[model samples]
Target: MRRPRPKRGERRIDAATDHLAQYGFAKPQIRNVIHDLLQLYGRDGWVFLEEGSYPMVLNRLLEEQAQQDQDEDGSTITDE
Candidate 1:
């Protein structure tokens, strides 16, 4: 049997999957982030980000979150 076509919203998600996976986001986390983004921006405004800005913005946010997590837990996270 052939696979069904992915929805429009999923196109944006599929585009981001590899990038997010490289940053250690599992499927659930990626979905949660997408959901949060949708909630933050509202449906009409929730277009996929520009390619040039996406990675930079996402990296900064992830770094900020990592710092906050480390600060709260008082643990040192070494980068590989």
Candidate 2:
């Protein structure tokens, strides 16, 4: 079944944060990063999944986290 649409503003932000929680990155920081990302695209508008920008950004964030882990000698990764 199709999922219900997210409400604009707070609900959408919360949903985005919740989605990000599935990752090892810091949730609050990632939320801020997501906000900045959305703002960046707001002027140009977003693209569909067939476009590479969305996945590229996500992969870049994961790569950044990996870099941070290496910088910390691999001790900062989240367990859950």
Report every candidate's CA lDDT: 0.64, 0.60
Give the clashing pairs for model 1: none
lDDT, candidate 2, 1-80, per-residue tens: 99888666546456545655676657676666666666767734334311553454466578777787788895565888
Q: Per-residue lDDT tens digits of candidate 1, residues 1-80?
A: 99888886567666665566676667566656666666766775334543564553376458767887989999886899
Which of the numbered candidates is closest to the native, going by highest TM-score? 1
Clashes within 3 Å, all models in order: 0, 0
- Off-target runs (Cα >4 Å) in candidate 2 are 1-10, 43-57, 73-80
* TM-score for each candidate, following the candidate numbering: 0.51, 0.50
Q: Which residue ranges in model 1 land beyond 4 Å of their true spot?
A: 1-10, 46-53, 56-68, 71-80
